[model samples]
Target chain A: MARSDDEYDYLFKVVLIGDAGVGKSNLLSRFTRNEFSLESKSTIGVEFATRSIQCEGKIIKAQIWDTAGQERYRAITSAYYRGAVGALLVYDITKKDSFDNVQRWLKELKDHADANIVIMLVGNKSDLQHLKAVTTDDASAFAESNGLSFIETSALDNSNVEEAFRSILSEIYRLGSKKALEKGSTSNFAPNATQTIVINPPADEGKTEKAKCC
Target chain B: MTDDKTLFGVSDGLLPGRVVRLGKPVDWASILKASQDRERREKEKRDSSSSISDLKSSQTSIPSIKPKSKKANTVIEESSSPTDGETETGKQRTAARENSSSSPSATSSEKLKQLLAEPTLNTEAVRKLAWAGLESEMRSPVWKVLLGYVPTNLARRNDTLRRKRREYQEAVNQHYDPYLDTKEQSVVTNSSTYNRIGNEEDVTFRQISVDIPRTCPGQALFHIPEVQQALKRILYVWATRHPASGYVQGMNDLVTPFLFVFLSEYASVKDDLSLLKATDLSVFDNADEALSNAEADSYWCLTALLNDIQDYYTFSQPGIQRRVHFLRELVARVDGNLCTHLEDEGLDFLQFAFRWMNCLLMRELPFHLIVRVWDTYLAETDGFATFHVYVCAALLVTFSEELQDMDFQDLVMFLQNLPTESWTNREIDVILSQAYMWRTIFGAAPSHLQQAFQASY
Candidate 1:
């Protein structure tokens, strides 16, 4: 489906890394296909899904790569870090072990991903409030200290799933725009500037163009 | 009860160890007549109960009398006649009970060993009866032969292992030579050149590297460098060879059972797998020799398995989608009411069955039982790819009552994490038997399903 509707201004590779059973695959499915699985098995190597979004008037096609969360999976997942412009560093809110491994995941990103890759600290499974082990305040503070954006999502309940992707993509787009302005035409912004689709609507059709973004 | 106790006491000791028959010798005609009468009575009772309960939960009772309603309807029609099919299931259960009473390991090993020795044995027949489940000790060799890791010819088996091990080492040696370098400049230079070939190899190598350590992190045997590198080499080589599919995430999981089973063969202590953890060099005493052989055996077996299901891992993953589609249709045909309930509740087959089909139900069952399931799959005609659809249908049918009762979220969650860790060989047998029944009924690609498949495409 993503392949069929491929008219996009920008293609950003966003990697999802977290602990096993942290629901990275479900999150990706919920966002891309509008589907989620409660019986989500541990990711094997790497699985990718593409979804296009309108961010800052540019068609941004987000190619999200979900990686296995186990320590050894880093071997293969680290390779996926190449060409990634964004990283969704996910941890289960109900799982303290998953939350504790966020720092290690951050280290993995730093080691393998691009230096300027936008990182998001996502405390997923927010719907499981009763079983919540990692508090929102604590996760937000941790994200703040680590210089990363933060969000809480419930893929099962379809809560914050869309906003999480939008936030990350918008952030990546803003950074790309800023970098482009500084360097003028020769901006070394991403893997490709040609891939980014910037639609310039006529001034009179502004309202319609804005409505078309979602 | 006192007479039974006296009879038990007369048989050597109070507990009959391995050699004892509980039934007395009866005339052949009487034995046949007795089973027939019991089967007839059982069928009548089952039919009467089903007719009474059919109105309330038509789908729920279908599995109980599934054999009778094989050709009934596309919507799980009620049985037309109670005596439509033979009560073979009752007989099979009795046979299975008898088999369990005997020495499981000794009898299974003997049957399998004999079958292996026969040059012209019907493997399909062997796989259908008793062989679906095997003894622990018999698995290593049986799986190796089943997966085509070893040649069926006895004379060629040793030579095959020798050549494959040598080839595996050569590949590992050549590929990992850069990692062995001490100097920084050479490593960088080599990496850049490696990148020049295409980033595919580098990505493959890195993916394998990360996944190997993570494959089975809790298991100490996997932590050892020897085991880790072996997994790495096998995965990397497979990815390199199959550029179209490359390395998907789940392929790593498929490789584990083979490696564990192969390594088990070389481990000195047969019963206790934990003893292998005591050694640092390798799990087995022969160290590198056994490790390399295991690596080679695992690599080939994994390759064979991927060859059968490679479409699932390809970039587009149409294989999984097709299988999932087939499962939906299969479920509709086999348990129409449950299928209708799922449709009403907005439950999709891909939500849970994708993993079921992709992993060949490996994720659902534990390691010991996974092999047993595979034993049946490997024996069937395109069992992994074709027969698996029925297995998925059978699994869904098992949860029909609960699925109908639950709402969307609960159903999705429940399907995602069916508590299967405690599932033993018996549970697998039930699922497999039900799957086999479905296969006989709807194995042929029916016209309705073909249209559904085409419409989706």
Candidate 2:
């Protein structure tokens, strides 16, 4: 499972961040492993998992980093945001406090993450409709104002979990391809620049990119 | 025996004359049944007239038969267990009798009993004995002294325990009661009010509640309602008292080893905690005083542990950062090739070693091995902070060959999910011995590691 796969067309590093008990870890597991446990342990440091999804006719391997959602963990978790190309800002629907903390989480990403990192504001735990405190309209309006893509997912019922990841990966792929095109155009555009658009490609390119980012 | 050879085959080069004994393959079903039968007999005796004498005789005999066989029994229960209802009384009796005579665990239990029985507890002697490894039956009281939760003088031990336990209960009432009662109302109010008013008590309570059920998700023990409530109260009380570090995420994992060890004091079967059913925990429900005592011990021991490594959970967690740095340098000095291989693959020590230092490898190893590891950690001079870096270096070096062959992603995943789920005492003994050897070599001369790193470059 550790071996690098040459088969992926692109690899996007995404992060999951939110307040405590907001289902960030469950969302990561539900998306990456198609597994969910009601009693999943709170992520202490950071957890890493990878899954390949078909997006825009390309295999986009999403390397997801799940972080502890406690406020104090930002000292360590913020570093993981440095090179992340995307982020899933998650919040529980039943808990108004988690949803209200979305603004803080967004400011956190703005502080630490890349300027162009694609973000999707995810209102999770849609399964608990009766106890819901945050409405879809409020979260949607919040996402729109912040210029982030929006989705409501239930990692428990497997609702919109896959689509949530697919949309974000596809958005990242679009932005990455655009960035590669612009870079290629200025530096004597090659005919095969499309094939070289893999984000943080392995070997020579991977080494330099890692050194620069990390 | 052949299976044991293939399973825990690694030799401990650091310790001489330490024979790693492999008892006959454990029959968990019969053992479980035997334990249950023993519980029934003990209960029947308690209802009878001669309960005290029978209890004393049974306690002495049970430990002799139990410590060795039950040690192996827990490893099996943690990893995999065979089907029950297969009565092998003959084989079970033979294995139990052979284990009592042949297993070193029995002898260690005897030695610990004698040492702990001394009027004035010999602190150094107990530390040395416990550093080797603790038998399940002896862990509770041994840990109480080792962690200094109980006084060394036997005359004052009970008084000290009563006072500390009462203080803990008071702290819980002062901090946790308001949160429990006003939890819904606080949620109804804006969360911004919490930040503005500096009422982190609500936030800390929420975090602890979320983490309690998640503490040991796989184990039924933590899932018991009483256990979960106790954990929440312990963590919440501790966080409230220590404002500087106030309830970090990894502190939840630190409490489990203590709770498991201390709670064993109340169980009928001391060796294998896995045999304990949720129904058995009813004792705690009925005897509220006993339950509170265990909770108080867990809280105090956790406080004692975190007191030594307070910086690890402080704002920036500088202690863990420094430890991770030291681990990297130590690994480079110990195994330059593996260190270079990791750097070449873009693997930073913080990427993996942070969790190792944070949870003390509790996340990587299974519950049984973690308890065994803590037997040594609590015995360390600096309370496992300085010595733990050496252990982390030893663990990395042990996997040097396999880690060198993997890529960055593979390395992180492999290190995070180490294949130690099925590890028995044999593997743990080797790792602890290796950790001790490295600590002895590099622990005294701090400059030796720096000089070694510079020379390698």
Candidate 3:
């Protein structure tokens, strides 16, 4: 039996950004659909998917925007970062250049995303251990230096894929609840508060889903 | 490199020297002619036994246009009648067909065959006829001519193909083959300079290779190694030649229809092309020269198609941006309720229609329907760019009722994964007809779209 994905206590807009062919799309598919494909096409423009996960006894629906990772496409993909509350900066461990380009992707987030966006540094393709180019300690040190949470994942073999998403969603939830507490607005924590961080509120009829952030 | 750039009139300042070599002008007219004769003989021999049955099957398989009620016919004539004075004969023919009981598909196919059979093809007349739909038997040659890959002059067609095909092969050799050889050799030698050059080329090559298997993954033909190699070479060479845009992802999808259409000319199957399989490689076996010719044609035809919408793939992709903007405005004007519904749901046009504009709805519609849609797109004066905006608006409005019932997530998923799998020619015809009607109405006025169109030109 599937839980009602439509009924959620919160909606978080997360973006997946990285260098081309670093498995950003596969990661999104593996997380949202619980499926993966080695033959997934290189993403063009952007793709969207959503999956609801339980956090703090509440349903947190994750709306993930999978953007094309090519350098040129940033002109278009960056525009989608405006209201995102979280980001997964992914790179293939088998490719050194993708790891090197992590700084550039971080700069892109700084330039386009919200100031409080929770970013996770993901070194994907952990299944390709023999060909690993970016080691865990190196990426971890880099993540620490940049103040970004770090995780290694294999969207191919399902290793750390679930944990990576759940960890980020929980981190975002913690930050949001802390902010709500700071504001002294217990209403914000109510089940139906509907105080969405992004876009306008939903109509009275409730026919349209609210495009929201944490 | 400077000399090569000067020779080719390309002053992009970004091209690498070794990748800029132009093919030496070759006199392959005799070879091409001989091959053409052989192909004709083979086709004739193949067709001789099945010609009658083939004709009978084609006639039956053609989705006959259902005779509309008198009122509907009048509305269609009023709305769809071509306004161009140049297409007077075509207009009369359309009118005559409305009055008569003649099958429009057979008539259009006959008209296309006649136009193509001309010593000097009348391209404008052919476009008018092909806009409705293309005859399966004549689509290959007609598409070549319409795309300008082959010449209008019957005498120059062979020579043009020979030169273009040779140029494509040379381009692959210059840009692709040496890089692969060097990469393999560099693995052993560990030369830094070779590594640098290999890395620069590898970015595009790797992306293309990763995408080739993914392009039309459901279609077995793309899974064949030989077919994948051909597609890779075409995309790589195109990317190399056009460094400004390089290899974009959606381009991989764009190449499929052309490759399939051109390769279909050689396959034993014709009527039900969806039945073509990866095991059908037997047709291409030992036919390297013929296969390469098909590959070259696909390259040039794809080039011709992309040339009109080059901005769609360039840095920033301003072409797609403008078209997406146009779609939003067009939808707002055409169906204000649908537009308000989407806006109220916080569903930006870019969120859903970006793929529609980027992939030319290839991601939305199925393979076969897309080819049929391309018939009108290729026939359009702008080669599917501006007219595509209107088509997208029409498509969105087609689903307005269902879209209004959904929210942002459902709308995005529904639009992205439209229930177009079961769509056939009948549904496509309606979409295209509505698109044409919208273009006719909104295309001429000095509206917002007109201003943008003028600025773009």
Candidate 4:
């Protein structure tokens, strides 16, 4: 089920989702590539990048998926939500409406992503503090009520860009390691196949009993 | 049509005008302010209600950040830190839109924003006003020094910084005060939140749907106005200079930093990655629809740039060849022999420089810092072919000593797996500057750079 590093302690898949101009691509570039642009082209399709991180001597590789945030493109991108352990739901802090659309994104996650997906709510473009509409307190409180992790950062200033990824990677690692421990001894996850295997009673048992009785 | 030479203040005619329109946008400030006030009050009213407006731009109506479904909230809570405080917000942008259409401020701001976005349609006043705003930015010292004119004298730097701060303060004040602001130099803020019915939402939604965020927009010819104009002039120059491949789609992004640099005096503000990407925009056009609208001259200029890149593209597209060649440049700079050694491995070349050649160092560094790297790339485009290689060297600098114990595969993975926060500008500068010095010492540089150094750069 894993590639690249079973030798390592952990691996995580984090998907980045947001509106086109809201800077999801820029945020991904800022995280995976460490680059930002005042003028960034809107994203076209899913772009994935991998980077291994050292967490307390255990190396964790982040399989980061950058998805198109456009409404129509979600049809193609919806397939990407599967198997993801983490999602960085990004929105532009300067644009209030983008901040408001977080619920729909969360719903989309619920519908498509794993049942236990770790979500981080990022209000991007923190460098544009002068033009700030969404306050940190408001976003934080919202996160509190909805059970999502929150951080307001500027991809431009490179603020908290690393911490965001680090926390998500480790969280995924913790979960994956726990799952590994839980299922490592018993083979892989049953996916409900356990019931089918455990009750594989002889189909001819009834026929044999009838023959004996006769 | 305004000629490029006069437009750029270039009397010698090295840069000609693209005659792009500079129209004034309608003032959307009042409506935006009113809406902001209303939103602020709404926040004050509920105190707990978090509106997801950004969602509206990407999603639709009355976005509630809370996932209404328990299954949604459960997955989030169980998976993340109990402290991961970010909540779900849903934008009822459509509702706001309905209300905005009826609001007087909304109508006017929308009109103004419309005027500003279109380069083809404009009133003459708008043109003068547009040029005036740009001109004002030209005089604005903070960004003018973005060209990186750091004064050697601490006193002068302090003076310049102070003067810039004061001027920014004044400009900001003028932005607020209608009377104090000259009609000629009005800086519109809170511009009516772009009053297109579904333009912002549609555009952003379209972008996200296709997974554009995780990928490169491939040279950014669409969004930036300055970039569009720069492509236009380069198109003109290409028509006269290298007409075979003039004005290709991706070329605009490549020239943007140069346009900014050409406008500035010292070319000091270090955002070389942005500068580099801007120059590299001429590589190819990914969006065919966008190409239909582009000027013919621009297409040709782009063609010329692409022609030299024929060899690399013979396999596919030549734009990426620079990624590899530039890797050589970066490695040679870091430890001339080390990069060469790695490259000579030959058989599995992809094993070592795949990431470097792939993302162009985009995956390695912070956004603005990339811009800083681009600033340098713009200045020395030929020698500094691959900008990210410097980023790679910065990440791997410790490798020289630390990795002496590790194998080559580990080295490549370590370089590939490096984190953004690991390196710094000082580290990069040390490598790049050394690379710069190393090259010039061996007679690789043009005399102009030497002259510039002699004159005290």
Question: What docking grade applies to model 1?
Answer: incorrect
Give each model's whole-structure lDDT: 0.63, 0.70, 0.70, 0.43
Off by over 4 Å in 4: A1-7, A33-41, A176-180, A183-214, B1-457
CA deviation > 4 Å runs, candidate 1: A1-214, B1-105, B118-130, B174-197, B272-283, B444-457
- How high is the lDDT of residue B337 in model 2? 99
User: What is the per-residue lDDT of model 3 for residues B148-185, given as tens digits with 9 covering 90 to 100?
Assistant: 56655555567767766777777777777755645643
State which candidate, 3 or 4, has the greater lDDT. Answer: 3
Candidate 3 is graded, for docking, as: acceptable
DockQ, each predicted model: 0.05, 0.28, 0.41, 0.04
Name the weakest run of 10 consecutive residues (lDDT summed) in model 2 chain A: A193-202
Interface RMSD after interface superposition, model 1: 13.1
Write model 1 residue lDDT over B1-457, tens digit each, in one string.
1222233221232121122345433344653454456445554444443222123123221212222121232122223211334334333323333344455445656756755654322233244333346665666777765554554444445676776677666766655544522322243223454433455565466556545655654456766777777777788776766666777666777887788777877777675346334346544778777778888778777766666666676644667868888888878877899988876664556656767776777666666667667776765546677778877788778888878887543565577667787887667777876776556545544567656655665
lDDT of 4 at B292: 22
Q: Compared with the true structure, what per-residue lDDT tens digits does model 4 show for residues B1-457?
A: 1221124322221111112223334234654454345434443432332112111112211122211222232232233211222111101211232233433222433433442333211222122222211221222222222222212122244454344334323433332222221321221244343343234323322222222222334443223443443344333333223223222222333433333333322223333344335442333243222222222212322332233232222222233434444444444555655555553422123333433433345555554344445544423323233333444544555455544433333444455555555566555545444443334343344554334333331
